[model samples]
Target: MDEELYLIKDAGVSPRQVRLARVIVGLLVLSAVIATPLATTPLLPIPGYMSAFGIAMIVVNIILASLLFAKGLIESKESSIRLGAAYFFVTVIFVPLIAAFPGGLMEAPIIGSNSSAVWLWCSWHTGFGLLIIRYATSSDDTAGTATSVRKSILATIAVVALLTLGATLGLPYLPEVFRNGRNFFDDSTILVPALVFGVNAIGLLCVMRMREEKPERLWVMVGMVAACIDVWLTLYGGARFSLGWYFAKITSLFTSLVVLISQLYGITRLYHGIAGANKILMTQANQDGLTALSNRRCFDQVLEIEWNRARRDKRSLALLMIDVDHFKKYNDCYGHLAGDDCLRQIAQQLLRVINRPGDVAARYGGEEFVVILPNTDAAGARLVAERLLLNLSAASIPHADNQPLGQVTLSIGVSATVPGPGASTSALALAADKALYEAKESGRNKVCTAPRELVTPAPPAFLMS
Candidate 1:
């Protein structure tokens, strides 16, 4: 029988564990109300009328538990496991209290110790209900309009008010009207519990409202729900209604333990998921698709930002523009696919040559690339460009049309300037392009530096005469 029951339980797994848990909890409450009184009455030595009344109270408890659990299951935003755990904890605490203090139970006519307990219980659970409602409706994004915050605050206040009224008007005085010539309100049975419930309810709502908008709010929601249920059961039971009294105590103990456990689990899951997502986004933004080096977009953004800083500090900046000679011809001869492979090989060579924190190489466009060298002058830039030419000449990528079977050469141009108010990025780029044109014009594969001096040619010899 046990094995069969376990199988039946195991088969019902789904994404919403809270939903399933609610169903199970509802059934347990139902069974407790129906079975407990019937079995206990015959065994107890109470009067026949009292026994019948006890049975009737059990029936009422069944109805109330069913209604509350149904509503909670359908409407509750809390996870099933959380709800289940809360119900379990509440039951544990209330069972012991009732068993230990049967005569101490609130009498029908007046407020007393039981009344206080009931008040606390109902207050706690009502607060829990408000939390559940808030959590279900709240979005993950908190930077929304102020209207959302105002609405939440108003809803929370309303919940607190309802809890307060329920404890004050329903628990203590209602029973007094049934008893002739006895003042139930004067007994102070319901007063202390009502006050306790009211205070706790207000505090719980305040704390919930104060929480920063985050998924973590879900755990707080669970705690509030457990606490609210506890208050409700206590208040109703204090009416000297047997079923209400039993359920009030039982559910309070059950709900507390479960809520705590659920909260811990939820927090852990939320943290890990958020951390993982952030890491993935960072990686994607920085990494190149083809070469696995920093791509052009990243290089452009980083260079502009660093350039402004360097300009402010009066530092030198150099740029190198490198192009693969006869790259288009090579692509035409061996197909575009081979050209891509050649480009990848050159990209790797650039990576090996430019090894500095502030130096970066990027594929500026088809068959052309750019390198930014911060704090480097024309001399430093020339040396780096020459080195890159030498490195590419040595690292021979396969080229069939050329004399060598696997030799690739690059024409590199170096341009440097100490940035001032008039020194724009476009001017620097143009200077580099002119230098690159000089290298290509001089020969197919060589390094060229832009002339530092602007020389005006002397008049032609015949014109001078």
Candidate 2:
């Protein structure tokens, strides 16, 4: 069976997360309530403050949009792509919106009209709410492809551009949002807030419907609730520079901030999960399955690394090629399952005899095992080979085969050398292999050392049972 990859959308929404969302919504509502009495109370007007806030919103929206776009592409979800386009639209429109504000970045407005900023603000909120609704209602049945998603995003950008241009060019024909050119208390201004409130309320409801199946929707719903409160405060304040207007802007920023935080948190969790999986995969790749020793692949890699290190440090590296003696006869008599158990026991004894941090033991192939001992001289290699033989004899694992001792035995070949500057790393293995063949040919149970000319062979120490 194929394993499934982790994605934030597939993550279940726990009860605690749901409770936390409720608590945040309650706090936002309470804050709105506290500021209600001072809604119309005028405060010091700072034009620079508006410009800074607008710029901050643009920056946040751009980052949020980019994150959503990446998430959409990675997960192949059209809903996420649509949501990202919504933020992108808002970001693009905000440039002119801030410039149109009185004494904004420039002394003159981007559009030569007093009420252009109000209209742009209304347009931004209304468009964002509609997009949120679109996202909430999108089906999850058909997954998005890369080409389709990019086309969708480009189309949204083109549409947003045309709408922004139309609004800017036709500002004179649009209904007036401010009667006194500065205050928002006029009946026409009331319509703006009412329209935004209705749109955002619908968006909030749409998000709520999907909250059970899509846990991520909980955060989106909270942001929508904040948007509704922001509109209500705008209506209550009824004027620029009023407490309600200021708090409303804060809530608007809070809406995007909450959603951005959720995205970051989910990405962080996915990163940790992938890191853990990679670690486990690396371990499995290097380890042998049956005996839990390093496999042949790992042995080859380690051998090359150790060989280079020995050449650089002028140290000796030893190789021990070991084979089970008359192992075919044992398997024929005891069955393959018993053969496997016998090999596992022999591997355990080999491990017990060669206890060194710099040593590596690996299953080379069927009925054959190999060991690498770094910084070991030929004499040390011989000592290790003898110890390995003694350990196996002590273990005395039964083998009902043609043998005088009637027990398992090994034929080992030992080779040790300080790698020369131009020596091929494979030379050490070739020499050890030759010695193993020689040992087997000499007798079924004995240790043999290759000729010194081939490499620095382990001293002539013949251990015969």
Candidate 3:
């Protein structure tokens, strides 16, 4: 069963895949660093560096795809943190590498020789895309299916928009814009990536806050602004003249993509954690803290709802209040812990017996329990009380007094009524309490019932005593 559950719930990857994904992303960052100087230096044109960077980027893409495949399996917080760190390292590495090398320094056909550079750039962006999609699609124990899916879709759309804008407008005119000129478009290229970065950074922060279930709109708004800036920068760069302008454009696009992907991952994780907490709360609410049975709150709700329906249709409602005989003495003898265990055992027995629909049982209070039997009459209630008494007595829960009271037993008080025009729950409860008192007086382990109406009679000697 454990294996089956794991299989059913397992995300499509194994632990090995998660480790590999981390290593791959890490290697990409390292490779990018090594290749950056060669590709950007005007004095040296290293064709090998471009290809190496491209291979590194491809490895990043593969890692991202692997993460996506194994999302279900990597649901733990530890796994998420590990993946996030890998992505963060890769993103940070890109800044220095790209900025340092700015357009492969060599004059001879370096641009054409740098196919690996383009591929590497594409790989990083694609890897980011995979991370975003993986987080969106990953199974969350907490969030409902609809909520998880909605957030994933929204994040994906936002990321795609940013990437598309960066590709179209930010890459082409960067050089002309940053050529130390006073032209409006020239200034725009330098300013655009910054603006986009600022927005995405804010967005990333918002996504982080959202994952923590905090109320913040700044991050989301920033992401929107960043996305808009990316589009503007892309278009302006394409029309610019400076070499620096084009570099800024591509870098900005890459940064925005990374931010979008990372933020989406954070939000998805937050949603899942919140959802799991809710389920735990619900489970606790339905259970009894002491005996692990249905508590009074659950019982009352079920009984009232069931009673109302039974009354509407003129069906019978039966109730039995079962009190442990000499429970106080038992606690005094065995200690509170043992008493608690005994109570739990009793509750379990009651739960097992009352298996039929419309039968509700609960721990009424310390040493007292109540069971409701809808569609049952006085006779049925009596039979149930007898069965409960016999079962408890046979169990022979230990009692100090061995002769008269040989074992622990329950004194059951039963009441059954078909609600009519003048029926009252208070009246029924009073009758059951009276019956319980009678059972205690008659003999400790016995069932008792109250007369429907009062009848004058001589007082007992015990009453006078």
lDDT of 3 at 78: 31
Q: What's the lDDT for residue 197 in model 2?
A: 84
- What lDDT, from 0 to 1, does candidate 1 have? 0.55
lDDT of 2 by residue, 332-375 (tens): 99999999999999889989988889899999999999999999
TM-score of 3: 0.49
For model 3, how does the per-residue alpha-carbon lDDT over 288-391 read when each residue is reduced to its tens digit?
Answer: 88887678888778777777887798887878888998888888888999899889878777876776876878888889998889898778888888888777
lDDT of 3: 0.54
Query: In terms of lDDT, which candidate is stronger, 1 or 3?
Result: 1
Query: 383 in model 2: Cα distance from truth in Å?
Result: 2.1
Comparing 1 and 3 on TM-score, the stronger one: 1
Candidate 3 lDDT score at position 375: 90
Pitting candidate 2 against candidate 3, the one with the higher TM-score is 2
In terms of lDDT, model 2 sits at 0.82
Most accurate candidate by TM-score: 2
* Per-residue lDDT of candidate 1, residues 339-425 (tens digit): 888888888888887889878887777788888999988899898888877777777676666544346778888887767755666
- Going through the candidates in the order shown, the clash numbers are 40, 0, 28
Model 3 alpha-carbon drift over 4 Å, by segment: 1-265, 452-465
Give residue 370's lDDT in candidate 1 (0 to 100): 89
